[model samples]
Target: MLLELRQLRIQPGQQLLLEDVSWQQFENILAELGEHRAARISYSHGFLEIMVPLPEHEKAKEIIGDLVKILLESRQIAFESLGSTTLKSDRMVQGVEADACFYIQNQAAVIGKNRLDLSIDPPPDLAIEIDLTSRTQLDNYQILGVPELWRYGKQGLKMNVLENGKYVESNFSPTFPGIPIIELINQYVQQSQVSGRTQAIQAFRNWLRDNI
Candidate 1:
């Protein structure tokens, strides 16, 4: 499997699916892929999906992640940013790698820990995914019980909050309440593309200071 994986050439913005993969095989594949690769993986039941993001996808991810950090810092909230970490639960037979994930309310629980086991530890408070080419599978996140999930794509930003063990679409973010998150993310992410990340982030910080 590892040899075949090495031969697999997935172009950017593309994905490949493999069926009937077991939990041990999934773990082995993750080990083979390592932590520094560009491909992201998601597994559910016996299906495995490997996606390589586009440049546009990564740009949005970094900018939005930075904006989130700024929002948390401005509010003096402590958080741990785990970028593209492989989150898996063997018990549930599910696994996923988020574009960016953060621990806010549960920050203390995972502090200084290098590895997270979702079967025992709480899922990230918020997870962000940039779906430029491939759509993210909501089942893995929903089953994992991530409190907040944000999906950004060509259409716009969509927020999903976990409720009753399922996902409910919302216009507001429970993590950063009372702020126009949809508007802010859409506006600033576009701004970053147009005027560069530094300027866009500075502008957002200024706007946040005045408003919040």
Candidate 2:
């Protein structure tokens, strides 16, 4: 069953809803997906979300191709079959759907599967969070073994990438190299809705042609 909670506010009296989907079910689904970097899903404390890091960063632009699809694009949604992979296992870890996830290409990275065992080594290169309800950032990444984490908040986006066993300020993304996510955010902010990816891409092509 797909659980769509826009603003999942879990308090003392509201912990009953989560009991519906056990962690094992989540694990089974991921295991079924086989292998390829699928969206990572996990929920801990009171937060539940999905995380996805494309194996081919270029695939993002291709996936977001054209205007019709772009207009229909959601701020934080997934493709039809691309679904998600969660980190909910045993009684210790809960799962949360990562608003956005970014990971670099590596042998250890989970790729092309319905479900994945993120508990294993080489989690995500970076995971992005647009905090809608939960606030358990401190231990969440550690639990997922993600190298980088960015939590979007009222004060814009704050980034942190693991370095030398410690989380530090991060301005660069290990996944999509040479692309400033901050600029993308600014573009999104500047426009109420993003233009069709095709149109944007065409514009980019034209600009490139003019310059080069």
Candidate 3:
């Protein structure tokens, strides 16, 4: 069945939606399509979404992930990068695969662990979502108890920090503390596209050294 799903798409980055799917069935599908990183699958309640992200979407994701890593490196912050890993919970019926996620504040808690059971282990301290086509359901992350979410869309990168079990828009990131993440990352991402990734990253590092 997973093999046949490939034939259903006529174009790249196309999206397919499935409704009224059982969690067991969703698990089966997820298992059948194990480790196929090109396709992103998301499940919430009884609905499942399979999407092939466009090159632009992937470009933004990569740059954002890279920028995040650089920031962590600059601050000497220990972090574990869980790149596009599926974070799910059976009990809450909430499942999501982020574009990029990291364990910064909770790094030590899950440093050497293999499998992450959200019921027992802590969730990613920060999750980044790139909204080129499909928008992430922020409410699902709220229920899953993700502390911070960085969503990049038309309005630029907006930080949504979890407060009182709900995400509220914030100007600063709790994880980075006083750093103007939105302005910095947005600048470097565009610079990378034009000046090349290496030069852009070098420029960012230089700027960071001078500023921080």
Candidate 4:
């Protein structure tokens, strides 16, 4: 599988799926791919998916992640940003690498840890995915038990909150109560594309000051 991966070239916005992959093979593939690469991987049961994100996918991810950081900072919330870190539970046979993940309520649990073992450590409080290429698998996140998920794509930002082991779409983020997050993210993400990221972020901060 490693040799085949070396020869395979997955273009941006494309995904390669392999079925019947064992857990050991999934670990080996992750080791082979390393952490600095552009491709994102997701494993559920015995299936594996490797996807390369397009430029716009990365752009939206960055801007949205930055916005989340600003929101947290303004609210005086302690948080840790772990960008695209692999979150997997061997016991559940589920694994996923989110575009952006934050340890907000659970920040202290992972403060000094260099590695995460989902079987022991708590899953991220919030996970963000840029679905420009439709590579996100909701089942993977649900099975892993992430509490909150933000998916930004052509349809705009959608927030999914975990309830009773299932995801239910919500307009407000539990992390940022009373802050019209859906409307704010949709408006600012579009603004970033046109007015530039720096300007858009500053504008968002200004809005937060006046409103919140």
Candidate 3: Cα lDDT at 99: 93
Collision pairs in model 3: none
Better of 2 and 4 by lDDT: 4
Residue 20 alpha-carbon offset, candidate 1, angstroms: 0.5
11-48 in candidate 4: lDDT tens per residue? 99999989899999999999999888999999998989
lDDT by residue (102-204, candidate 2, tens digit) is 4444423445654545554355555555432334544667666668676554455566877776778777755434545555443443232366445555554
Clash pairs for candidate 1: none
Candidate 4, lDDT over the whole model: 0.91
The 10-residue segment of model 2 with minimum total lDDT is 74-83
Candidate 3 per-residue lDDT, tens place, 47-123, comes to 78888777877888998899899989989999999888888888888777889989988999987776676767789
Clashes of each: 0, 30, 0, 0
User: Estimated TM-score per prediction?
Assistant: 0.96, 0.51, 0.92, 0.96
RMSD of 4: 1.5
Residue 191, model 4: lDDT of 98
